[model samples]
Target: MELQTLYNEYLNIKFKRGLPPVRTKPFEYGLYADDSAGLFLTDHPEETFTNWMYELIPRDPHYISAPDWQPVLADVFQQMDIYDELVLYYLLFTLNTTLSVNSHNAYSTMNDFMKNYSFLQLSHLSEITRLNEEQKHQVRDFFFFYYLYAHPVNEETLYACSFDGQNLVHTKTDIPLERYFTAFHDHYSTNIKEYTEQIAIAPHDIQACKHLTLQLLQCIEGKLAKLNMPEEKGLEAVLRLINDVDQMLQLHDNNKPALFEMMKNFLKEARSTPYRDHCFTTLLQNYASYILFFRFDEIHALVEYFEDTPEWCRTIINKIFMDTIFMERILRQKRIDITTYPNVTQFFEDEAKRIYL
Candidate 1:
C-alpha cells in the first residue's frame, strides 16, 4: 500500500512540477542522483503534495524491522523540511546498503555507504530518534559498529546523540582475520592470486609480465564467472573503465625486484607474528588474492613495496599507507611492530599529519 502511494505521489509531483517522470537505472550512480528531482518537487509543488512525496522510500519486499525502521523513518519525517534531498537519498542508500544485504551477506555494504556520506548526516539520524530505555542499548551497541567499521574521517562530528556523545569511549571488537579474509574471498573469489612466480621470473621484462598479467586477468575472469560477476568486469576491463592504467602500471613496474624483496621480508617477519597460524603457503595465497582483486584502482600489494629510500622518507611512506585496507589489516594483524597507536584512524591521522605539515 505504501509503495503504491509513494509511486502515485511521485507521478503527481512530476505532472504538477513538469519534472521528468521516474527513471529506472537511468541516473548516473551516486548518492545525489535523486537530488535534482527532489529539489524540483519541493521547490514548486503544493505543500500537501510535497509532504506526501516525502513518505518513507519503501524497503524491498516492503518490510523493515520495527527496531531499525522506526528510528530511521522518524528522523526522515523530522528532517523533511530542510534536508529533503539528503533524507530521500539516505532512504535509497539504506535500501541499497543495509536492506540489500540479504543477497551480499558476507560483507556489509553499509561500510561503503558510510564511506561516501558525511557522519554529520548520520548523526542527524542518530540525534532525532527517540528510543525507549530498553531499545537504547541496541543503539549504543550499533554506535560502535558504525564508528569502528565506517570509513575513518579526519575529524569527528560536533553534534552527538545520547548514544554517541562527545568523547564517548568505545572498545573495538576483535574478529578473526581468517573470517574477514574468507568473507572477502567469498565475495570476490578465492581463486585470485599474486602471480609471484611470474613476477620473480621476469622482473625487468614488462613484455613478459604482460603475458603473465593477461593470464592473471583470465584467471580473475574465470573466478568472477563462478561468482556471477559481469563478464566485462575483468581486471583489464576495470582498468579501462576507470582509465587509470598509469597508477596500476607504475605499481606493476615497481613490483619487479622491489615487490619481491618486500614480500620475502614481510613473509619472513610474519612467521613470528600472531598470524603464525597461517603458513607461508596460505599467506601467499591470500596476499595474491588481494593483489589481483585490488587491480581496479590504487593497486598496491597487500604490503606495499618501496624502492631504495633514505630513512628520512619513512614519514612520507607511512602517510601513503593511510586509508587503505592493507594498512588496516596490517594494524589488525599486529605483525609489523608499528609504533603503538590506539586505533587505525588515530595512527593514520598522526602519520598523515607528518607529511601534510
Candidate 2:
C-alpha cells in the first residue's frame, strides 16, 4: 500500500469519528510508511515524524484515540530504537490529562497512577541505554517536574493548626511542612526561653545540669521534628553539649554557672567549632535557598547565617539586627520592619558572594 493512501485512510477514520484531522504532516507520513512497510526506517525520518506528531496531538484516548496509533509508535520505536521516550511521553501525557480533567483532587489520583508505573526503573532498560545524553536528561527532567508537581507539599502537618490562645487546634490534618510555624506558635510562644526553661529544664535540685540540658535538648528535638526539620546535626549538637556538661560537672562539683560559662566560653574560644559552624552554615544555606525561593520579605537574610549557629548566637543576632537596628533605626518603627532592611540586603549580598566565589 502506498504511504499516502494509508495516511488518507487514517485521516478518514478520524474525520468520520468527528475528530480533528492530524495536522502534523511529517508524523502522518512516518505512521503510514512504518505501518505499511512493517520495517524499521532509519535516518532522522522516524524521530522527526514522531516528535512532530507527539507535539501536535493530545495523547489522551478520550480526546483523540486512534486505535492504530500504538502500533505506529511501536513500529517507529522498533525501527529507530527510541521507544522509551515515546512510552514515557505517552504516560506523562495521559497522567497530565487525567489530572486536568479531575482538577479538585488531581494530586492523589496522579500519585496513585505514578505508583503503578515504575518509569524510573524502566528508564534503565537496555533499549533506553541507547538514547543519547540529551534524551536521557529529557526523561529525567520530565520525572523531576512530575515529582515536584505531584507532591506540592514539602513540610509536615504539625503546623497546619493554630492555637486560639487556649487550646491546640489543627486546620488540616494533611498540612505541608511550610505551614509549621502556624501550628508551633499556636501552642507555644516564640519566646524560646519560656519553652526551654519551663518545659525542658527539670526542677529537682538533685537533677544534674547535664541531665537537665539533655532533657531540654530532647524537647527542642521533638519540637523541631514536628517542624519537619532534619534532626541529625541538630541532635548531635545537643548531645555534644550534654556530654560536655556531664564531664564538667564531674570535675567541677556541679557548678551551674561554670557550665553556662563553659558553653559561652566554648562558642567564644572555638570561633571555628565544627558543630557551631555547621549550625550557622545550615542557617545561611536554608535562608538563602529556601526563604528566597518563597520570596518571604519578613525573614532577614541574617536568619540563615544564624540558623546553624548556636542558639545563643541566633538570639544575639536577632536582638542586634531585628530589635536594635531594623526596629529602632533603619525603619524607625517600634516593631521590626520586614521590608527595606539595608543590613539584611547587605548580609545576603555578602553571603551570596562568599557562596559563589
Candidate 3:
C-alpha cells in the first residue's frame, strides 16, 4: 500500500480512538514511524497504541526481512535510497554466520540510520568484524559509489536505526560504541580511492570540507599530544604543517624544498616584529610530531633530504615552525574536535594513511 493511503487509514484509527493524529505529511509517514519509536521507550499503554499503528504502515523498502534475505538484498539494491550495501553485506554475512555463532544473536545488527540521517552518506560505518580479501574489494566499491554521489547537507536527521526486536521499544542497546568505531574505521580505510576522489571532485563541498578540516587539526593535535614540545615534537610538527600547506597550495612534490625555503624566510623576517620571543622550537616539535604520526618513515627521508640541501636542519626547522604556527591558527579558529564528531573520527582513520603513507 502507498504510504499516504496507509497514513490516512492510520489517521482515521487514531481519530476514532480519541488519540491525537501524528502530525506528519504524506511522504514523511515512514520517518514519523521511526521518530515515534522514542515515545515507546516507556512501558505505557500508549506504546502499544504506537506499535499497532506502526504495524499498519507499509514496511520500509530498506528494512531487511531475514526470512527471505536474498530477495531483501535484491530489493535493497533495486531501491538504493540510503542503506550502505557494503555494510549491509558485511552485517548480513556476519550475523548469519560468525557473530551468530559467537554471540547467539545477543547484539543488535543492521545499519542504524535513525541515529543520524546523513550518517550513511557522510560517515563510514565501522567494521568490527573481519572479512576476506574478496569481501574487502566489494566494500571498497560500495564506498566509492556512495561517496561519489554523496552531497553536502547543512543539517541532517536520523535516516534509520539499528533495531533489537519487533517492537521499537525493545531496541536493545547491546552493541558497544567501540564496535561501531571499529566498523567506521574499516569502512573509511578500505575506501581510500573514493576518499581521494571525493576530495578532488568536491573540494567545495562545504560539509565534507568542514569535516576534513577538523580532522586535519585533530590529527595534528593527537600527534603533538604524544610528544614533548621543542625537544621531540618540533620537527614532527613542522613536517605536518608543511604537509598541511602543501595540501592547501597543491604544490608539486619536487617544489616542496622551495616551499620550505619560502616559509623559512617568512619566519626569519617575522622575528623582528611582535613575534621575536615566539617559542618556534616548541612549535616545530609539534609540527614534526604530527608528520611522524601519519607519515612515519617518510619524515626520516624528508629530514635527510633537507639535511643535504642548502637549507639544512636549522633553516628547514625554522621554515616548518612558521607554517605550523599558521596552520595552528587556522585549526584554532575552526574549533576542530575529532573526538566529538564520529564522522570526522572515521574520516581521520580513513585519510591518515593517505596523508602520511
Candidate 4:
C-alpha cells in the first residue's frame, strides 16, 4: 500500500473502529478468519439494536490470529500519533512487500512506477526500521526513483535527499517520507565550490565571497529544521559533508588558508547572530577536532576567542578552563604526552591563573 493508503487507514482507525474484523460483540465472531487477520478495532462500542459493536484492529502488520494482544490507545491519547505512525510504517513496508511479490509478473513494469514513488529520490531521509540490509537498499532506491520520476516532492525535500540504489546513504533525520536529501547536498556542494573559486580569485575580498557559502549554511539550518533527512542516508550525508570540509582543509595551496580564516571568522560572527545554531556549532566542532590534534599551539587561540561563549559552545576550549586537572584527564584517555607542546604548557599556565585565580 502507498503512504496515502496507510494514512487513510490510520485516520479510519483513529476515528471509527480501530481496524476491521471489528465487533460490538467479540463473542459472536470468536476470532476473525481471513487471509488478512481479523484485525480488531478498539474504539468505543456503538450499539444498533441487537449487539454492541466493540473496536478491533490488527495488533500489528502481521495480523496476529488472536485479538488478546491488540493495543488500546485510550490511555496514551497524547502520544497516539507516534503509535499511529509506527503502525502505519509497518503497514507500508508489509503492503509494499506483499504487493511487489504478488505482482511479480507485472512487477517489472510496475516497479519502474513504484521506484518513482519511494524514498530514494529526495535528499531528506526518515528512519525505516525492521528491514535487513538488502531490503533497506532496495526500499531506499525505490523511493528515490519514485520521488524523482513519479511524484514531485517539494524543492527542499527533493534536493535535500540524495539517492543511489547501490549505496545505503546513511542519514539521521525524522522526515524520510519520499525524500532522499542528495539533491540538497549537491546544491550545497555547488555553492561551496563557487565560494571556493571566488575566494581564490579575490582572497582579500573574503567577506564578500564568504557570504555565498554562509548563505548556504544559513539556508540549510532553517531549511533542514523545516526539512529533515533519514537514518542511513543522514549519517552518510553528514559524514560526506564533513569529509568535504576535511578535503578542503587538506588543500595545500592558497584556498586552504582562506577557508580556515573564513571559518574562524564565522565562529566569531555566529556567537552574536541568530545563525548561531547547530549548523554553526557542528561545523565549528569539526574544525575544533582538527585543531585539537594537529595545531595544539593554536588551540590557545580558540580558547581565547571563545572565552566568553557558553560552556556547551566552548567544548575543547571549555575543557581547558576547567584547570589542568581536566586536561590531564583528557590526555590520560587519548594517551597523549603533555610534555610535547611548550605553548600548551605556558598557555595553560597563563590562563589557569586568570581562570582559576
Q: What is the lDDT of residue 275 in candidate 4?
A: 20
Winner of 1 and 4 under lDDT: 4
Residue-pair clashes per prediction, in order, are 1, 10, 29, 63
Model 4 C-alpha lDDT versus the unseen true structure: 0.32
Q: Sort by lDDT, best first: what order?
A: 4, 2, 3, 1
Q: lDDT per residue, candidate 3, 202-239, as tens digits?
A: 22222222232233222211211121112123234343
lDDT of 2 by residue, 141-259 (tens): 33333333343322322122332221222333322222222222222333434445333322221122122222222222222111111123334543333323224223223443453
Candidate 4 per-residue lDDT, tens place, 42-139, comes to 23122110111111222453354543432332232323333343343332232223112112234343333233223211222222223345544543
Model 2: lDDT of residue 213: 24
Query: Which tens-of-lDDT digit does each residue in 33-125 have in candidate 1?
Result: 333233111222322111221232334322434423332223323422222223332322322222111211224333433322222122222
Please, what's the RMSD in Å of model 4?
24.6
RMSD of each: 22.8, 28.3, 22.4, 24.6
lDDT of 3 at 331: 34
- Give all TM-scores, in the order shown: 0.25, 0.19, 0.20, 0.24
Between candidates 3 and 4, the one scoring higher on lDDT is: 4
**Candidate number with greatest lDDT:** 4
Q: Rate the local accuracy (lDDT) of all candidates.
A: 0.28, 0.31, 0.29, 0.32
| True-vs-predicted CA distance for residue 172, candidate 4, Å | 26
